[model samples]
Target: MSGTGDDFKWFGEGFDGFPKRLPEDVVEYIIFIINSKLSAIQTRERLQGFQRALATLEKKFLKEYIWQRESIRMDLVCDNRRWFLRGTTNYGDSVADEWLIVYFLRELSQEFPDAWIRIYDTDGEFLLIEAANAIPSWLTPEVAENRVWINNHHLCVIPVSDHDNPKSLAIEEALSIINDVPTKLQHLPKIEQEAFYRLKSFPSAISENQHHATLPIPRKLAYILRSNPSYIAPAVEAFYLRDPISLRLLQPEKSRTQLNFPPESFVSVSVRFTKVLYAQLLGQQWVPPGPYGEALAKLISKESGVPSVSREKAEIGIKVTAGFEMLAQHKLYADKKATREIQLLLEDIEAGDEALPSDDEIARWPKREDNEGWLDIDFVEFEKELAGKGAGSTTRGFGDKNAQDNLRKMVERFNKFIEDEDAGLDGAKGLGLDPMDIDNDSEAPPVGWEDPEDSDDSDDNEDDDEQADKEFEEYERTFEKFLTLSSAEKSALLDDARELAQVEEAEKEEDEEIKKLSEMMEAELFSHGALNLGAKKNSGVKPVMGDGEGRGKAKLEEFLEEVDDNDVEYLDEDYNLAENMLQAFKGQAGMAGPAGNLMSMMGICFPPDADTDEEFKNKNKDPVNNK
Candidate 1:
């Protein structure tokens, strides 16, 4: 008020007219700014934005809000409409003023019963949540649902009123499709995009097939197969995946739903990467931090874009990436080769030494069978079980007339997958030990097993031509199929090559992510387990980590079991114990010289370490120390 500038003139009008024109809302907003100590210009900026929102609100409040869409019921004002909502991005902070406007309109909706607030992110992302006096669902089936989500060209409507009701098969199938859309999109790189599109087009295509192409169903499928013959059973499997009993396709949408304070505001998160920031203060662990923070710290440090992003943008990115732990069951990956993968996965799930698979996580993956032990699996059934839900083998469409074309397409796709994975190239490069390099150079010093610079058989001129021929032939044969492909095919193959380097790159990234998740679980487990173990482990004294006690004893037992299983073989009752002992003795000495040397060979019966009674005094004794 003291300033003489024209800007000061408007400051008075803002204070005066906003209260009169919007008495209820202006007072609160003005007080909010004053309490927060906003500057004169800052107050003016916010007021202007508020006025503009009002201007937009004036156009359609009473008309649209009179009777709710899809209903003849008279609309009534909901008592509370104020909401402060955000996505799980940047620790749940709203990125732009549009969100604030959304918040403002939500409040305004309460003040005016005849207002229908429609708000969506202009960015074409984030959740589109609609709030009104009432939403239509279940009990109010004639009316629209509480939420209509249009995300990434996908529609998923959540009818809150149907909370306790069971949906019909059609709706559930549609729901499943939307629910899994994100994973399908993520795995698109593994399969051709066309195959996915064809699967998704089924609902419409199947109906069409009934009307237009019913008679030539097999022939039409065959014709479509001519171009993409490799699609095979997987495609048919995906097509029939709408089995009502098991699977359906759904769009994948990341969501957050909450009842805000004041109980009037409607809140929803409709997308995975919505810009709701999570406010993580300095020094506190990020809302969901890994238990072992080393990996997370490295990830944060290695974020090449972190330095380049502004503080505000970095906050959003942090929140966005935080939601990446989508559901992927490791058990679904169980196979004969699963031992290595599972062991590697469990390596991260460790807190010092104990395996940390959650009870629920391992419940049905058929581990040691849980003291219902001595497991024997019918591998035929085990393979089916291992495929898990929504596996490629979900359906047996291979028998359909489309099998031949599908097989070819699958073969081509698999070959391409291997090429894309560079599984073929690595084998080719394994021939780096080129004998030609040594053979072509006559006077070069020979490479020796013990010493590199040792004169390479300089005195002997025996060049093992046999080994060289074998190496060259093997190398050629390795690449023979790919090499013999036509030029066009080769060009296609090269185009698909992309780079094998990415496999290692992705694997390293996956390992880091796994480590990050493990760390979070690790810290949690340590707090729950280790903290409680100190008293039991120490016996009111220092921990004895090396003796048979808490952690050490457990670890020792596990190691011995692993060693025995790996290094020893067992026989059935058919062989007598004496015979087995004799057989082992025979492998050791083979009765090679005869009984004439038996006395001198007493060295075999009396091994060098035989007299040492102390060697195994503590052998297999439980380790009694805290580890």
Candidate 2:
């Protein structure tokens, strides 16, 4: 790979052998992987696909693909506001390739110049699939409105991840922790391990028994190293295998190129280096060789206080800032063309050629004059007021204990959302003017609020359960019991039904005679002898009966009316023809063959009113096609 020109400046990582002129689909696929919109299985498959794509990436074309793909990523990092339009759930070949971005800019520059760009991707996968292939018009019902209004000063950047992705990188950073055998991650110092955990898997716990716990779970995991040194090596090894997020620390390798942050994710840098440094100090292979290893050595030496430097003055480690701090540090203002100016400033910083503005200068930037101060709204108080849980707590439907509990939970959930986004909200600083005071109602749902899609899903499942139970109860025996029956037992049931039906048939002397006569006549009339004599066989057309008429009586009357007795030279011929016609045309009043078969089977298997006196009697003498 050749070195890139000085014009392209990404010194830290991933721009070393940049590509040029590649397929847009490749870029889109990279974006999809970054979005982490796939399942554990899907993400694994996707990562494998990416690895294969990279492996097969014609060495000659590597430069263009890397450069173009990175360009899209850099543009996103440069201007957070453009992310207002998210990647839609349908993420096909739509990761907004260079040309796509250029086209979007062209569209905006020509028309809807003020439009905040939208870039949502789909399964194209959705924000979270409530079910298959359904992308919500809006991630949140409140956010669902077609329009998204982002103030120039405080554009929010929502971080997304593939919690289930299992791919890992085997770069210098990951490999340095071990030589060959057991892999000595145990010596990777507590301080170093703490830094990594805080960045990669912070705010998570194996189990949280305490309510309102401020998820310092990664810190807790870090604490384990200090508490028990022997466990560190095994834990780190297990973490690497179990947690996909740990891959963020490693360098860009085939099949693993998505970095977890901008140029300034200190925790990530610190953690990756800690492992390599631990091995370097121990005189191991130190496989990953790069400027990053040198930077880490310098950072550690500075922290440990060099030969002449005082330990007190040396930095302990890199400190990470909140999202709001990042916004303020950039010094963005809601002034005209602010996004472009901010991008330029960031680019300059990346180039190491621009000096940051002084504190006084940054204070002069726009401070969200029209924005709502997130702290002012109280969702819980509002819920209590609406439900009257306290003052008139017992006055209304709140009397139901379950109702009160539900309302309380809803309130807590809404409030918890505010707490989570507090960092972003801080960046949305008020210009000292009250937004609610200016307008009675704001369209926005409380910050970080999500639609109750889960609850709806549970309700749907419950409805299905109730319907299944109702149908199940209609059966004489449970399905399990039916399944347990032997073939002989099942056949014996048929024998009993057939015998009982035969007895009933014998009792129906008046109708049995007609039935037998019909059966005999059909055989004789359709015989080869009768056919050669030019005698007409039964037409097979069943006649319809008038209201309330018995099927047997109706069929007999129709046969008598249609009979050509004069044409039948013999009395026997006339009788046979009429009987055969009536019997052959005896139909189930309105059922197709399959339905009639099913009904008959069902009746025999699980007779209704089993002990009823008329058990063997026909219920539908004249059948109707129920379907």
Candidate 3:
């Protein structure tokens, strides 16, 4: 039965050394060992077994043995009771220490069936119950006959003479001695009162709705006062509670350590003090506190401004009057200012006034002029001209029908001259003249020449006849030489000669007017600078006089520059010209110049005027005009 301090060690060690300084892992391991060693039934059996063993050991052990074992047993029982006590404390039960109170209450309930009793004790000794009446009629008969002997154990009942007006003197005495009464209830002294008025008043005193009306002081302060009534009662009796006015006027200086101010009246004081502190610290009007603090303070102040039930209480009578006034002022200003702005806006809308047109709208509109002070050319006309000539049709020509007919006739005559030269050379071969002889005899008539015979022309005839005879004799000799060849050889030679003649004819014809027409076109384009000669020959039919005029170019440049310098309407005459010019050069080879210039004009024209054409022109003009 004897044991050393180690026997008591396991009590403090906890189920797994949970309350002692053991490592968590060791504690867990011990818990596992304990659980493995005991099932639910075995755990209950072990408890009963230990209790029985303690009773037996207490009787049989030596004095020292009894002391050590008793210490261990006491520690074990205390630890177990503590575990159960925690489990029951929420329902106001003390499993180990307060069982007697519960037992007494149950017994009294049975003895006095029509009434209930509440017992209060300070040190777990003498018990006192406040009863509505004496013992029940059933119990009074047994007590009068002395058959119940209730005083045998710790049951001592001192009966009241007047059961209808039972006193709480014993209950109060018991309550006064209980050391563990909550601090809020410790100072109430024992008093002799038959009706228990204080207990009856407890419920109403604590009800939040009734606290202000029935309590002499603020609920929070009264609560403090009641708990320490000994200290507060004297002050209440002496009428020494601090003046509310003095507290209201008191303003605590700002302290960095304290952030919260009393919410009701103190908000303004805090705000004003905060402003002063801010001005002092940062040399400026008040800025809000840190983000979180400002948010919380704002919420609290906003709530304080609204009336609540607590506000009706004298103790919490402080109101945010100034804060509300300031808020009202701000709201009034905001509303008035907003109303004025709305009125102004409505007026503007009614008057049909608007800000300037957006840039995108202006961009989408047509253009006018460029920077060079030239009129924008109508590219549509140029495109029409180009389209007409590009098809290579004579209908697109510049001159009237008569002029075109004359030109056509000249081309035909030139072609006929080439055809005649070819025919002459072909006939020379048929006349028995060597085509080579014909080529060499450029001054001679072709081989078919013969003079008409006249009867009186013998003298002139002699000269003519002599020339003819001589030419014929020479031609016959050349023919005989040509005829001396084999038929096949002559035929072959003749074929070769004919081909040479035809080639020569073609060369002569090509040398005639096609070359002339080409040169003329080149000259025209070169002279007027209407078109560049270096332009591809396939460049569509030449620009005529009107189409190629320099006047259009001058006008275009002038219009573009003016449009560029001024804010002219998009559909203005100049803008149409620029737009047409832009369209003209979209796909054609010659359009690049006009297209680029037109786009440049469009960019400069639509925006607000940065510089004007007159200014630019005057700057470039003669000094007399500049003056």
Per-residue lDDT over 512-609 for candidate 1, one digit per residue giving the tens place of the 0 to 100 score? 99999767644543443332322222132222123223454365446446664445333111112222322333333544322213324453231211
Tell me the alpha-carbon RMSD of every candidate. 31.7, 30.3, 56.8
The 10 consecutive residues of candidate 3 with the worst lDDT sum are 24-33
lDDT scores of the candidates, listed in order = 0.30, 0.31, 0.31
**lDDT for model 3:** 0.31
TM-score of each: 0.14, 0.16, 0.15
Per lDDT, what order, best first? 2, 3, 1
| Candidate 3 residue runs with Cα over 4 Å from true position | 1-254, 261-314, 317-627
Residue by residue across 343-370, what tens digits does model 2's lDDT show? 4544665587755443354335332221
Superposition TM-score, candidate 1 onto the true structure: 0.14
Scored by Cα lDDT, where does model 2 land?
Answer: 0.31
**What are the per-residue Cα lDDT tens digits for candidate 3 across 1-627?**
011222233655653442222211110000000223455555445444434544553344322110100022211222422110001111111111233223333333343332212322221111222221223322221121111111111232333334534322332332232223312221111211211322332222221111011111222222222222222212221112223322222222322232111333221111111111111222211222232233334444554333222312212122222111122123232343322443344355447663322335433534321121111222333333434322245333433222233344344434544555434744421223434655564587668644555546666778999999999999988866874577579769977998999999999898887898767754543343433223332233211111223443465556557664355444243344433332334333443343344345655322211134454345566777655
- lDDT leader: 2
> lDDT at 40 for candidate 1?
47
